[model samples]
Target: MLKLNYLFHNENLAEMIVKNWSYDPESTEMFRYYRISSNAIYPFRKDGRTQLLRFAPVQEKNKSNIEAELAFIKYLRENEYGVLVAVKSNRGEELAEIRTPWGVYYASAFVRVPGSAINQTDLADEIIFSHGHALGELHRLSSKYEPEPGAPRRWSYIDVLDWIDDQIKEYANAAIARSEVQLLREHFADLPVHTRNYGLIHYDFEYDNVFYDHEAKRCYAIDFDDAMYHWYAMDIEQALDSLQDCISEELYNHKKHCFLEGYRTAFDLPEDPDAVFPALRRFANLYSYARLLRSVAEKWDHEPEWMQHLRTKFEQSMRSKSTLFGTKLS
Candidate 1:
């Protein structure tokens, strides 16, 4: 825990909050504000009040992304049909000049929304419809909202293919790569079958970001960490397919149908949604395998030789005609 007295108005974590965090990790208990990243998040709870102090650094990678996320939250509150809320911290308070153990600290905050995050198994009828509707709403909002003059949001299907191809080249063990290549190639081939559209998007809406109250039968979205202007279709596909394991045929169909139905209710899906969905889903799966290959390789030291085994495992899975959803792909 880096001492951040000068940052938090000269207050430490214990001085700022009243909680039973004493039994928590010693490192967290040190700073009244613990930075989740060198310059991202610092979560502290006091008197049942939890606040995430966020900041952006000048020299940080995607430092400007902080601005984008904040802007997105502002947009969501105004237009989207969800219960999520954003907390506006003092401007430049996060980007303000402050000294710290990690260099400098920035500041931002969300409403400290509470609930269990969403999972695939939580896909009941109403929730499925809601997720679909949310996606559609997002697409509609993105289509109407304009980006900040200049944004990086024009990646193509070929570009996605290149990302997967490059990852496999960069880190794949030969045994794994060879087996996974067939499925990847098939997916890449299908990419040309669909066209892409650009729009403002909540590019990071994954299962964990969605809150599901199974009892109340309501759903909510949070965590605008990865929101950005992007291909709206790609963003939706990435969120739905990549984040949740759609392993059962019935469940996958139900989820996909509900997602589409809900989304269409809010905004217009493409005329060719059937084609668009599968192409995008294929790309996401290939991308996931690419990620798996690299993570296993880089973190090999942390997990022994399991790296090779996992790589091979995903490699073989890709070759199967059926997706995790149990649907056979063309």
Candidate 2:
């Protein structure tokens, strides 16, 4: 579990940040702070435009990680990808360091992407297809990406699993969690990796992370904080999981088919993309379990009602070993 007490949760600190960045404190029209996992995101209005301020503890996100993330964003922008661009500070740095009573935090700003989140609307085939196409473009570009010599490398799948293993070891279902992780490791070990098949990817390419401009029929991606080195198929699986609660299976399948078709236009996937779902689903479950444990360990003493509800949901999912696509893990 990562510590989050150092977050810029108050207006005073938020105002200080605004001034520190040479932005007009009086021009701040709206400001809010929220947390997702260990990261603190501050979305605010200034200069008649919306912008996002994100910060994380140094231990959770070091300088190298920040540079890597910003570099990837810049690369994507240079390649004409629709992404939220990072804004340089007054000091001409993409990332800035802020010290508070709790700890040190690394902060960065991004220009707000135009349009609204796709999650606010019904799932349309065109939107789904566009999502797939955009991700495919990212994969194609990532296939050729080369980080600077000392840039932080994206975390491998095994790295995430090992982190989760550490989290679940103290839980009541430790053995079950460990076994599931081991099975996933075995399955992943058998998969082939090549430039065309593996590279950095937007691992969380779900609706909320993407914005849709209905008029322009374009999709813009934001929040590359979770981007990592993984198989291209994993991004597809995660996108499908985001649509798990569609009205019916028929509509879901139709949307998925459209998405895959769009993806194939840019890069070839496995003959049966569905074959990778089981392993990815198991990984998602383990990841969720690990997050639940970490959240509890960090915030259980001050847990809110929503957090408790989420804990209940995670516990049930873990006990059943349920996959996102309506299958039970053996």
Candidate 3:
């Protein structure tokens, strides 16, 4: 259920179901235009309070994996990790069942969260450095719990690298980036030796996945739906990559250094600071393949802009990795 959401939206139109969730006839309030993605996120009021509700469908195979995540978030929340206060529906169901155009989907909600998602400009020394500290705290606290085999944590670079190669080869029959895929494949074919293992990470850690208050110097990370096992070094790259994408060259380097300093203050590092680039470059390869498949799927859903932009971005990501190999990555 916590998997990438685009599929749910395409498989079943969730917006219509969300509209049905509202039993009120007033229809007086201006409903913000929200798309029905894999999840239905709606701005609603309960007892005069406004909040956001997010819901998704689950299958039998993934039920425990999803519930374990909710349980962990519950544990972390109790431990004062400062995560979302999950809003459960009637009868205290954190993961509830709801019938919809898509048959049935799981549902959960939360009070309207604060702060805008982070961007490059937000990587000023204060903002990003604080974010790094907060993330380090997250890794520190979350490391307290462990899963037997087969529990879902954030997805890692290694978990998806093989999957990426599979997908790129699948699209090898298309007009997509062949050379990029080749370079990616060449590196992936020999990745196991260079990869480092680390502690639990928010494998999906990215700037956009977190919220920040530049004024208060506070940051919050959301969407642990992809939380999984991986090296904390990967988490470092997750933070740095977002800054590099959002900010200018000069600020990017500065923010990255300070962010690393903050991270080290809270946790230990497994690899050299330079390791972040190669780690993320390898990560970017996997990201490209995922987006390419998603773009293809969305194109079938008539999202031309998303498809084309992802295609262009995929090539650009590959091009960006043209140098700095053998030394850092190999």
Candidate 4:
């Protein structure tokens, strides 16, 4: 019943969905939709407010996962975290289900955060410190979070490892990838997980996902689509990994101090944070490779030249063990 070829390219269907949210299709400017994983992202504006529209195929995200994501966003908003808030549809539904001839898709809208994404050139100590503090606050809050019974839980590290196992089974370098997975599992098994150190975290808490308002001195987080349950230390390491290109040895030491200083103000951190870096970096790289594999496997037959180039680059990175985190691999 569904037309696979026209699924993502259905502009008329997209416009209809947008209109369901009480926005005029004629007045609203729908930005081009691009693929992020299996989802399609469409950013648009109406009535002086910028909004983001997201669509995920049923195969990508189930109804429970979508509801859980929205619930988490509501929780963050209730706690006063500067996260993009989900918008309700005309029927007071936070999520919209669209059944098209091409298949079913889940749709959600969010009010765009004010300000631009933080860039490498503007990586000041204060901004970095504040970024750490924001994450610390989120962790602190997550430590006490208890979802209602039967609510969807985010993917665990084990779940990701299992996914990697399935993805790399036929990869050219399956043996090496399997070894990395085993090592990561061993490392994670040794890491302590307690109330203070383990919780749901914004797995993609990178500069691009954070919008900095200079006037307000605030960093608003967006894109919680990748939030997951993990060690708080992993979140910290992920944040630093995102800044590797912007930091030199001397600058890293200073920024690390400042960042940790701000973080400590909100929640307690481990004394030897750097000791955990090597393992976490490996974990990050493995996940990155898995993601690249997923993308390539899903679209290889119809992939654009640029996507093919990206796959090549990712394969090189995996082989060299060189990633955004740093040159050294553990």
Off by over 4 Å in 2: 1-9, 27-29, 33-38, 170-173, 298-330
234-294: candidate 1 lDDT, tens digit per residue: 6667666643473375567657777778777877676664566675565555555554444
lDDT of 3 by residue, 230-322 (tens): 656667776777777787786777778788777766666555656445645665544654554544432345545654565576556555553
What is the TM-score (0 to 1) of candidate 4? Answer: 0.86
Clashing pairs in 4: 2-101, 3-102
> Lowest summed-lDDT stretch of 10 residues in model 3?
2-11
Tell me the TM-score of each prediction against the true structure. Answer: 0.59, 0.87, 0.71, 0.86
**Candidate topping TM-score:** 2
Best-first order by TM-score: 2, 4, 3, 1
Q: Report the Cα lDDT for residue 115, model 3.
A: 72
| Clash totals for all candidate models | 10, 0, 9, 2
lDDT of 2 by residue, 219-316 (tens): 89998877778888888888888866543776887788887887877777755668877777677767766765555554547656665676676557
Comparison by lDDT, 1 against 4, better one: 4
| Residue pair clashes in candidate 2 | none
Go through the candidates in order and give the C-alpha RMSD of each one to the true structure.
Answer: 8.3, 3.3, 5.6, 4.1
Can you rank all candidates by lDDT, best first? Answer: 2, 4, 3, 1
